[model samples]
Target: MTREAPRKRILLLTDIPPCSNLTAGIVTAQMCRFLPKDELAIFCVMNPHLRPMLCDDLAGIEMKTVRKPTELQRRVLRGIRVGRAGAAAIEAMKRIALPRRLIRQAIAYGRAVGATDLWAILQGQTMVRIAAPVARGLGVPLRVHVWDPLRWWLDAHGVDPVNRRLDLALFDRTLQQAASCAAASIPMARHYEETYGVPSTAVIASIDPALAQAPPPKLISDDSVVIGMVGQFYASEEWAQLVTALKIAKWRVGERKVVLMTFGHERPPNDVPDEHLRFMGWMDQPEVIRTLAEHCDIAYCPYPFAERMAEVSRLSFPSKVPTYLAAGRPILFHGPSYSAPYAYLNERGAAYLCRDLYPSAVYNGLAHLIEDSTLYEATALAARGAFLADFTLPRMERAVRRFLGYEGGKAGQAHGLEVV
Candidate 1:
């Protein structure tokens, strides 16, 4: 008798994808790119209100659009909506009601597509209704990926005491229900285990290898120094802090320049007077890397004072950390000493860390790197080495596949195949 082919069906449920400005959307896109295309079938569900834009962008994947609510669903949705002000109320209600319905729909959709396994990516309180029952009812293992716990808590409707605690109760129940869970970083994983009493084995998060193998750094002119920072600008004060540091760097380096490169929806203020500062907005990944490698001399990873709380700080590991490492340059990190990237930097001897967001501190750090040729080369080389050893896409793929028990050749022997 012939052996059957391996089952390759998977259903990924998420809120944002190709059309949104959120980090979740970017991470979801990266996940799709990392998985073996021939071995995986992706089914995505996004906010119904964004269907038009998302439909066009998600052309290659199988997708279903879910609207905010119809007249009837709205009535049930309204009771669950959280927050007294803004659209948070409507969004809160939708989170509680939508996930349960979406999971049921996902089961039917997966069955129709001959899927043997189901994977649900839970954003926040939605985990309670979406992931729990599907794992129990379908007898298929479920994985929950958490990025921002605080954001989830605040944004989730009906989870708090004022909302009758229905959502919070359900959210906790899903933790016990899921077969496995994944977080964006080790810190996040720890948070999940501590707060929800989930097993450590259930959490997994990694950086893609493709991102690390960015084209080798290109040489630029020596007359001006370019300091680059990427990702969305959520806090304007943080941007101003960066700009202030850049201005201080300019004063020290004389003619050296600084530039802000953004990859999302946020735009820089038009009235900023720094000639050294230039904003390149919303570039694709390849373009973002190319621009950084060719023009940037230093990569700045600055965090403002507002992001210091343990609840917020412990749950997030900036995606840009690996991207900056892959750039083959010296990194200037302005954040807490206990941050994950700081730990990595200290381990590898690859970066400069600053406790405060002072201009003088920023200037001194960059000056040390620029002035000492030996230190500059050593730092860059160490960062690149660390990227290959720990943060490469193939490295991450192996870890994920092993965690999922998807990495055997015939019977039990694991074939160490290269990740494409």
Candidate 2:
């Protein structure tokens, strides 16, 4: 007779704990759904100072938080006056010794809870180093959630090139052995799957249904067309092009006006003319979605088109897609042909897409939205369809659950993986 399998208990090791104040934490909370309280635990490293940022998102179940090794080491080094060699020695020693403590603590907790699975959240370096060794010691299948560009992430965190190469190698090995993998976007998942021949699922953390409702119809000004953008601003030149297009779309004796309204940022836009711009600085997300639905005629999404951003463009899907889709706004994509957002919207004919950076090209796309009512309705409908089809919290949760245990998960073997 076959022996019965043990119940699955997960131990998540991460540098960013699950909290509502940050995007990574919010996404992690979604992954926690459909699991029993006692079955999942979090062992995370966060700056104690950011404790105020913690919310009730993870109020129950088991959790532990520790300061990063570098944080602790820096505090120690400040207390003593050491020569360069001595300082380097002390720092290296602490780095080695502290990770040992983390490893021991992680293994102990895993054993205490009879953990059947090990999960790692890769936002930075420490967890990547710590989780793999601990998983090896625990004899459990390792599940990896990769949400950031690895090289970009490392570089952002001040990792030098030589060490970045070493860390990348370790990351590859860890990914190689993982029972399953999840990426932040479809392009990222495809790249990892092709490179490592491992099953990887694309999981975009999307809004709840309450936030996905279509905006109530409203009476827009007959002469004004409102275009809205939400979330963090990154591509400055692209935004300038948007402002320039708005200016260009003006004139022609009683032609309808085009207005650019933006939310979720506090900084004043650069050289925006008074007649064409509205900046609502940092509204709450629900309100932002509501505003997008009720008021805006079109939603704008852009990505950098420079050669330096090629990898990022190809791999990282814009998080704003879901927001725009959910709000039933027709997405106005301004980016290179190779970007993830461009490929996604272009493939479905779901948006008024512009491939060039010129103000005239951008204005033409805007004019299509302003002049063609059919284009607006059709594009919005297609975007909403994409949202319902792929981008939603429930869909994301299902993909993660399937990858975690539903199908190919076993106690020891991790070779054969099936995509959900």
Candidate 3:
């Protein structure tokens, strides 16, 4: 009898807590689902905080948690100075020591799971550092998923100068050591090539087939046109701009009420009129998909026009666009044209894009979409077509499979691996 080949083991190292509502977690779950189960064994890191939500059934997979050695100390310190100073101190320690701790724990977990054939790290400067040494030690290939450009995201999010510098250095070194890298967008791939001299494949996060296969129930209201958005609103300026644009659209569509329906956890600006906005709080994926399909007449995907956003926009794509497109609603892309979603969707006639970073541009785009039913239908159809052609789960899975060198049969299994 022919003997079966040994299954290659893959370790998925991520900063994200699995089974959460976060985009990275969802993407990681999909990656787990589509990878060749017969040829590969999957292992993932579980954040302690997400243990309660760990009910997602990932059969035949192994999971490990690396609790920080300093977690108790950090908690005690936090208890002592449970305010700004304490927070600053803990952040400093995390920046300085977290990478090493994560790496050590990852090594321990890797050994427990037997020899690993490859290391798969989700985007983050610290995660890259944690995975790189393991891959090098095991003589195995490492794959880094570039969800966002780490350097720019850190800078944009107000990371301290010292930590930012250290993280960037480590990030650069990690990429140099990586066997391959996958980016969320083509522009991101090109940026990696130009900036680090490392070629990358674009493996964009895409929509699940279950979510994309059906059209939402049509619930049109004669009195109001509901414009919906889902996800965290990280930038206040962007939210403020959106409110201003909504006001403008309200005026243009005289007598027709405009409602901004939002889903997810965030505090809306007090300045924006409460009557115009409806906060749905947080909902699960199924509810979100249902609301998008049945309730919304228009979908809004906004990126901030802040310096950090403009910088990172050239290097990453938003995971939310596929969801917005799958809703089969007219989409208003509010952000710089350079961003991947705006650029690609606008080029494909899938959305009405506001290239200029002004509320007037938003006003004009909204007015054009709201007033012309023919244009609205055409744009909606284009978005659905684009989602099917480029942003569906099957399409993404095929691309990722090719990138991982998992062609037909159990070919190109990683070799020369050693237990930690």
Which candidate comes out best when scored by lDDT?
2
Per-residue alpha-carbon lDDT of model 3 for 1-420, expressed as tens digits? 998755566666665544547667777666666654443444454445543344265544676655432222122353475454554466567766776766666676666666445546555445655677777666667777777777765655455556567778888877776667778898877777677776578888776555763433332776677888888776566667768776656533545788788887675663556787778887776677678778788888887677756757777777777788777776888887677777898778988988776778776787787777788878888878888888776667666665555547532222211111
TM-score of 3: 0.84
In angstroms, the error of model 2 at 13 is: 1.6
Q: TM-score for all predictions?
A: 0.77, 0.83, 0.84
lDDT score of model 2? 0.73
What lDDT does each candidate get?
0.58, 0.73, 0.67
Candidate 2 similarity to native, TM-score: 0.83
TM-score-superior candidate, 2 or 3: 3
Q: What range of 10 consecutive residues in model 3 has the weakest lDDT sum?
A: 411-420
* Model 3 whole-model lDDT (C-alpha atoms): 0.67
The total number of steric clashes, by the backbone 3 Å criterion, in model 2 comes to: 0
Residue 141 miss distance in model 2 (angstroms): 1.1
Clashing pairs in 1: 48-66, 81-93, 159-168, 208-393, 209-392, 209-393
Give one digit per residue, the lDDT tens place, for model 2 in 1-420. 998767778898888777655656656775675465567888887755664355464567688777876532222355776654564465456546777888888888888878888888766666767878899889998888887667666655555445567668878887888888888778988998888777898878776665775632332567677888876666667887877666554532136766678876355466666666688776656777888888888898878776766777888887778888888888889899988889889877678999998888777887777667777778887877787777766666567777677655422212122223
Better of 1 and 2 by lDDT: 2
lDDT, model 3, position 329: 75
